[model samples]
Target: MNDERDRLEDLNIEEAVGRSTPPDLAERILAAAGKRELDDAVTPISGRHAVPRTHRPTGRRMTSPIARKNWQGAGVVTAFALLFVVGLIAFILLNDPSAPTEQDTAETQEKTDQDRNQPRQRFETPTKKREPSSPDSNEEQPTQPAPTDEPEPESEPDKPEDVVDQPEPRAPVEEPQPEPRDTVKEPEPEPEQPKEEPVKPEPEQPKGAVEQPKDDDKTEVKPEPKKVAVAYIPEDAWRKYEFGRYSVRRSASDEWNSIHGLEKEMGRIWLYEGWQLKTGTGELYFSNGALLQLDGEVEFHTHTRGLRIELIDDDLYVDNVASSSTVFVTHEGLEVEVGNGAAVIESSSGKLGIFCVDGQVSAGGKLIAAGHKASLSNRGLSSINEVTRRDWSHPLLTGARLRQLGIEDFDPAPLGGMISGKIETRTAEQLGLDDDGHVAVDNGGSASVAFRFDGDHETLRGEKVRVRYRVKGAKKLILQMFCPARNDNFGTDIVPGKEGEWNVLEIALSDLRNRETHKDAPPPGTVLSSFALALTGQDDAQIEVDWVELVREAEFEK
Candidate 1:
């Protein structure tokens, strides 16, 4: 063993040049030894050299000793390099481990098939530590001894090539190992936790998904979504919203007549060519299933030929999403939309404003996408502004644009209440109003004031009534809500925290409860009546209000 290791260590290039001999000196010694042997065997020709190597070979060299001894040392070096490289590569491959061939594997399978009748004998992978002096060297190192139970097979004992070619010496035929690409990779040492304490895992991701990192050896489970109960809408949705008393005319020159009673009535009413809306907020359903809600002092004329609405004098709200034809909202003969669209229109002085709440709308013959506001006048002047990052909830939701005014709502209309209060407007040269406009209220003495909601916003998230007021010399404030469903009043007392500072009172319409029973009396979102605020304790108490906004929350907030 000692002599075999010493001879193999001599072949190592790193250990040889570092300790045994210098690389250049070894080459020179080999050259000199070869020359001396050739000189003793053959005579050298004086002043004569070998033929040029680049030219093709003509015949065997039969003359010079230089040519004869030239290939001997180089042949030894080349053979040594080839053998060393082959053995190193083979050792690396065998150590890496692979699936054994049928001849080497000794798996004990039941006698189900002919091949599984007898288990094959297992053979260890043969290792090579060859240290050859040359390709033609007669000296060869013996292989390591196998286990005592399994005797090693003797095949071509004198030749190393025969031992390499016939890896399984005992077997009749050589068998190749399974290809590395086809074999499954060895599993990595993953979780070392005890199998008895198995952890609950998250919803099993689809196969081939990358595993997420573990937290305290536990996988978090995803929550299922909550289902929301939606109210069933009937085929005749117009019956739900009690339509107001409207005037109808057969022709443009004919006089209009009041056909329906003044109370809140249900059912669809067919409109003629010259049908018009009278006083108060009214809901109109066209023959083509278009729902139009008109508020303020809007004098809109309906044209059933193309489902076009002509705003003759005031403003209108067209949410014709269910309409079969394109519900066009025209101001002064100029249409705003050419497709199925829901939009809000408002006209204050001479300028007209069209806001595309959803779907597409047209402005000055050019189409604009949703969430965009377009302002136009009869003088062929128009400007379009995008209402970005806004999930507008209701048709009444509008505001000042591009820093024109800091006010949020501009569509404030007086909900009927007999009181002394002040109303203010915040619009200038354009129509960007959300709530009917801001109501700047100032009380001269202790008195009650009321506000009305112009449009009935029955949205998914519902509407909110916001009131901001400040009082002096008042002990308690009363917020009374008039519910039309009960035709009665439900109020709650609000104790002001601060005396002179503005106190905000914002509550959802659906959250409004009756003070007597603490139950939601209305049970509906369309709180279209009046909201009254009264100061009863102090006689000389003065109240100052900023604004009262009736708006809906955005979609993303839900």
Candidate 2:
């Protein structure tokens, strides 16, 4: 418009000064506008780039002088590196805050002494502080929480209540004391048991003094003492007594026959004779003279006497008989064993003491030159001849010793002539005769027979004899004549009888062998004739006799 609008306003004002003039901008705008217009160049160009044509600054605003002197030497080394990083951050916050508070108080006292000694250090540090925390109670596995600031427990919590409140404190020790001496002493001895207790009390005091005398005499005892005896006596007063005491009265009547002491008067006691009555009683007989008896118990019809024979107590009895003959019978020296045929005739005209107690007898005539003499233990010394003419050879016959005293057989020729047991006679001084013819055939010719004989040799010679002569006071009387078959002596005789008195003899002997006027002699075989008796007495003179026998044939038997 105004020029074109003024030429388009000068082409829009020179393209606004060539677009603000840049192309090295005139070397910087003429070096500042040539020193800026030397003085007051602009003060207001500030931000928008302050457009300036050809002032060139914009390659991001311009720098280049070598980059501006390398940015002002990098601003003086960055202001000294920012004052050395502010003094090294204040010297690491002043020595790292007391070295982290002295390593945080020595790691909180080594974690409160590893939480009281490493409670296993939390099971030994797994991954520290890695927390996902929550599982706690199976009783709270304890570990961590220890540090100190004020929670003090470093060792105290060394637990179990600190091993129960801690009180073991002692240490400083010492004591010992005592010892240092040497004294010096020695002596001891003793124990011998008090000298054996006084020698055992002297043997117990004699056993308590011998038991105190057996306990003090217990009751007055004295015992022991005895002896005393005496006896002896004998001075004969009939030699004293005592055996069976005493006795003797006697005299109870065994027929006194008026007797007073003795001397005859005991009659009637015949048999073989025994009689002593006068109170010592005795009477015996039996060979048929009969009168055997004893006390009649009082019926005395008489007959008893003096001391005919007696023995009492050893009892032999008899007395006062014939109270009709059977009053008190028999028993004297009883022994009458007479058997073997009895023909006993013993009678020496008187009995002094007769005992034959047996049998056998045969004697002929002339009362055999007076009496007495019939002795034979066995038999011997006997003679009888009816008529003698003296002649006897060997006629001392006791044949076979009288058949050994039991005489069973006998019969030596009987003619009333030879009666002889045995006979041998001579010794009148060998028969110059005298000396009273020395005949002693048991003192015959008197009070019957006196006997006692035990024979060795026996004899009896017989013949019809008659012999008697006893001159009690001598004139002459001597005879011994024995004849068996032939030695002979036939001297006649003279006689005297009456000294003790008794005699009667008449011996014819067949007229001295005339055999009644010569009957041819020598027919008397072994003949023996006898008649003998001669005694001038005095050999205890006893003569008495009675004779009578003349038998040729006279048989008398009772």
Candidate 3:
């Protein structure tokens, strides 16, 4: 058995020796293992098979196994990265934040349409800040706290001890809240109605009372005419003054009866022919609107045609004569036929002065025109002088002219010691004068009383000077003309024939010369600055001037 076992062991040892390869075979196994390691270092983890390295059929050498494996792995990774980028781009497009969805766009369009259809509403905003609560107990509170059973304390009267211990209450904090928005209300749609046809307006009727038309056979009514009024004078007419003193007498067959019983009668008294009417310082009006102004004493007889006035004394101013044919008999037995005009007749010292203020007068068969004065006596009419100018004719220095010369109102001033006098304004009746009414004078006693004219006397050149005056208890009256430019004076003396009676004295410029001896006299045409009058008489001497005037002699011619 031992011998057989020995033979087997020898055979195994020989086989083992056979299995132990040569060195070249060992090197070939190591090189194959190295190639696997290099492939693992470059192969991707995706488990792809690595391509085998081979040489080209030509001369080119094949690529390395590791390089081929790296190339395959790189291609696989690039494909995967491209897929990842494409997926990220698709996600961004689907989830864009600024783009609106389909549902959101529809909702925004609907909201805009609603706003356009609705009406806007307005709300007034408050301008003042809200105020905190007041401390007074009686004041109403803006907000009330939850009420309790116990009454609220009356804000305990401010105690000094409590003030230091207590802190001021803080205003409650207001949380932020959304403001209430003004809601717009949509207008309701109007209901539709059926259409109707239009109606036409009717014609209007006229108003007010209407008169019916008359037929052809009807006659029209006519209005009556009116009557006019007529004026007439009674035959038995008489008038007595409501004021003044007078007496009347009636004429009968060879007898005279006193009409004093009829003095109180307001009715007309029958004035018969040959009846006499006497008046003493009074006035009377006839029934025909005639006025008889009598001064002093006057007697008149009612004639058949008119009246025969006996101017016993004083003067008579007769106005508004009813009869143009009335005849007046003066105290000198001269008859004056007066027309429808006013006449002033004065009878003094048996001389009658008749002045016709308006209309014409006939005395002693001579016609005296209006504004003319005529002197009459028992021998009939004497001289007739025109008192006023006609039309544009040059006027003479009459009473009106003297007034124009600033002599109507006299202001008296003493001229040295040689004169002492006063001036007075007298009426025509008081001066017993006629023609252009009122007169003025200087009544005093002095050696010489100077009268200065208020205006310039240049108008007195080449004129005749006439002065009518009455002197009482004076021997002579002298008038002097003073020319201030030449410092010279001219004068003339008057010799009176009657005392206490008006007398006219005239002086011509041709006769004027310097009265003072050894003084140069002014030429004939020299203007006078002032005029003076001198009265030589005793202490009781007084004088009255009726009028002083300058006239042209040719003015008196017919």
Candidate 4:
């Protein structure tokens, strides 16, 4: 058995050697031995090559004895090698202790740098490692600070790869830093909204950009009345009869006449042509504010009394008893009063006249007659000292123009011209007189001319006619006419040309319609019932009247 074991061992050894031997081994052995032994030793096999070994080098060995050994020896060899490597590692560690520590720190810094590079990972790391203890341990490992984290104002910058592990500090600082930059960028984009507000500006049109228009103002206008003209012959003739008011047109001619007595209930009065007064005697009391107007001649006896009388282009014949008669004369708006009817005419603006056929005459106030004296009382032709007055040297009334027309006595005449029968006079009481000698044939030194005409004395009963007259010494004259048929009154006021001038006065017959007398009558009738004239005071106080003419102005429009 032993022998067999030894044999087995030898065989094993040989087998190991055979597996490990190089290709040139046999030749190298022969060269070292310096002999040719191969031919006898075994002309050994079917495969045998013989090579010369003289060129082989010496002392180059490849195989070890232990490597060629069986399993136990191989195990023992491996154990020895392990032990040697351990010893070498122990030597390195013992010599420098900081090396391992430094290595560990360097690994941690690399991880820290990676964490810093990945900001999302840094924010997520704490959630992954939720335990406070684990995070603290991770933090305790010294690491490079993250570059993404905002630097402290006092802190220096850190390197890129060395900034991975400081997750908590870097996360908060970087988060807020980006927010500030985002806030700055956010405001920069929204200021473009103001361009949309300018489209609503249409309110400037009515604020005075356009202008407006204008209109006119003067001139007196008169509205046409229902009845324009009228004519009436008083039914009863007034002799010594007193009247409240009476207006008559000369049913005989185009001339007009009107009379008013202010007494209460004096009854209807009468009128006649030429104002011829016989023994017709009665007093007219005008204590009740009656207005009277005379167109032709108004005769006053000691029996009649009156308050206000206006005359137009006519003579005012007065006796001694008809005193204290206030006569207001008007051409237009001018007015004047003659205190008493003593053969005197008072006008407000223009000429005045008195017809003194029988009674002693006196003149006062501003007299316009060339021969008439100022305040001269021409009593019974007792000529006073001749007061030679110069002719009007004014441009308005040059003597050359005055002489051309042969303007004469600015006085009233009994008749305008030569007539037929001795101007007939009649009274309301049916008293008639033939001659001028019977004018004041009574118990008193008084005379009144009164008469009445036929009702159909003219073709048209009533029609409108204007009266034209020349007023002496009238710088400005106004003539007014009053009609009692309708109780209407109208007048015209004249403007003086210059000083000391005679003015021609024209009056409209339509204006003299009597409103009260014909209240319900139609507008265009031809009755001129009463008339009044007045001369209001002006620069030229002297006045004379002549040649009363009548003209028709207008007919009432339908």
lDDT of 3 by residue, 202-298 (tens): 2222343233322210121111111110101111122333322443443222222233334232233323223445544344433232345566544
What TM-scores do the predictions have?
0.27, 0.15, 0.25, 0.17
**What's each prediction's clash count?**
10, 60, 0, 65
**Cα RMSD to the true fold for all candidates:** 34.5, 85.4, 61.7, 61.6
User: Which scores higher on lDDT, 2 or 3?
Assistant: 3
Candidate 3, which segments miss by more than 4 Å at Cα?
A: 1-420, 425-428, 434-449, 459-461, 518-524, 554-558
Candidate numbers, best TM-score first, in rank order:
1, 3, 4, 2
User: Which is the winner by TM-score between candidate 1 and candidate 3?
Assistant: 1
Candidates in order have lDDT scores of 0.45, 0.26, 0.46, 0.29
Clashes of 3: 0
Pairs in steric clash, model 3: none
lDDT winner: 3
Q: Best-fitting candidate, measured by TM-score?
A: 1
TM-score of 4: 0.17
| Candidate 3, lDDT over the whole model | 0.46
